[model samples]
Target: MNFFKKLFGKKTGSSNGANQGRANFSGVYSTEHFNERYNEFSLEKDMLDGCLKMIEGYFIDNQIERIIEGPVNHPANLDQVDQSGFGFVLYCQAFELSEGEATMFLAFAFSDYLITKYGFKLYKDQKPDHPLRGMTLKYDKDGVVLSLYPFEYTVKVLKGNETFSALEEKLKANLKELPKVDELLKNFGIGGDK
Candidate 1:
């Protein structure tokens, strides 16, 4: 619809630069290679939306509050991270998921939501000389970019031996403040073009 038109209207950033990795070109961020990757991502739009809906339904079914109460077009900020929020952790623990399962699922759902709704695109750095070698990167045309796993440090909150109340206390009292998503990218030498 109109959204797709606006999103794909003009590709910018370091997309067409030769120094960028050549393979797996998604038209949103790169152009040297074929845009098959972009095509795949475009085609998966429905699946991503469906997954969001499924998560919403699961929460409703369990009588927990909806993580996303409205349209998914919110700003992509760390303070607004829904998947790994307190309610989400409770849901995961309620289902008796292991720490690995909870973290992976939270990360995937968070990534999917960001891509489908927030205009972010995925890029993997495969070049040997790149500092972000082998990292899955995410960015928007507005120059917000970062490692895909921004919650890497936050996941340590999920110690397998802790009780839910104890985990909550640790998360609230012990964990230091998380950096903003763009700040996190800066730490990895990624963004700051603003």
Candidate 2:
């Protein structure tokens, strides 16, 4: 038998044919669906890691106290993208912006890094009025807050959410747990003091 045919031909319920059953069910999920889900998951993971690295670099570089507590919250389905073939809309929030300068610099640095590193085009030039291009700094009864929206449509960092701080802290404490994120940070010159 030809190699192709032998490899995919009849299964004889043997040790080597264990995957044959899975092959039979492959048609149950279309290849496109599989690819979409996989891609969405990958994008979300990358985005989360990217955010962490950006914050870490900002903290280290500026000598600011690290407020990140845990892994970013995973992307969730949103109404706008629910039926748009997009899998999910992820949101992250960082807080305790008492260090205003560092927070502003970090947000801009992260935006620049995203554009240069990932080719994520900003909707417009960085300006206060630029819809997807500006940083918002606010002061409330509690403290200062900075909200950063890096991606035009998919990702955002909010303020005033309690869970956000907790998540950030968890991420910082468990930095070693996410190897892939660490690799990305190292590649981007984030983890090192330089």
Candidate 3:
């Protein structure tokens, strides 16, 4: 308890319900609001701690010996991607997943958030968007697996995608150079610097 207070600072009650609470995360979408969108409920504090711990293990397993947290970026949500939990985006050292390789960038949005707000449709039952549901991470999942494949269509109709593309190019080019975002990602144990 004392450790969490030191790390995440104080936890505050959320107005939504008596059982729910909001944890501070001003710089990123780590608030309980967004965190709840991904983790299973166990006590707001414990869920967060678990993420932190999991992140740490990932770092060691991946051999990111020195570097800690990575940067947090909120790229505009893609129409093709689920937006509900599109809240947390962490940029880290590149890692590979069973699904595929992610180039040091990941984003998360809540499957449950979509279901509760939009209706609890299975990831497959959704509509034209059904096929795209795989891009959105489900509750209790770890990092998001990023691939531009999900945005191929959305990138066309959406405005500013060109700018986003340019920014992305620059971001990819500078992934290791960005200090604070990298540091925060390190603290979160999301990934290590390359």
Best lDDT among the predictions, by candidate number: 1
Query: What are the per-residue Cα lDDT tens digits for candidate 3 across 68-165?
Result: 13211223322212122211122122322321112112212122223333232222212223343233322211221111222222232233234222
Rank list by TM-score? 1, 2, 3
Give the per-residue lDDT of model 2 (tens digit) for 1-194. 00001111245556875543221110122345433422211134465465446444443444543232322121211111222221112211233333333233334434444334323333322333345334322111111111224322222332322222332343233322322433434554657554
User: Which is the winner by TM-score between candidate 1 and candidate 2?
Assistant: 1
- Of candidate 3, the 10-residue stretch with the lowest lDDT total is 1-10
For each candidate in turn, the TM-score is 0.37, 0.21, 0.20
Off by over 4 Å in 3: 1-26, 29-34, 39-153, 156-168, 180-194
- TM-score: which candidate is best? 1
Ranking by lDDT: 1, 2, 3
Report lDDT per candidate: 0.38, 0.30, 0.29
lDDT of 3 at 138: 23
In angstroms, how far off is 77's CA in candidate 2? 26
Among residues 3 or more apart in sequence or in different chains, the pairs in candidate 1 whose N, CA or C atoms overlap within 3 Å are none
Q: Judge candidate 3 at residue 43 and give its lDDT.
A: 20
- The local distance difference test score of model 3 is 0.29
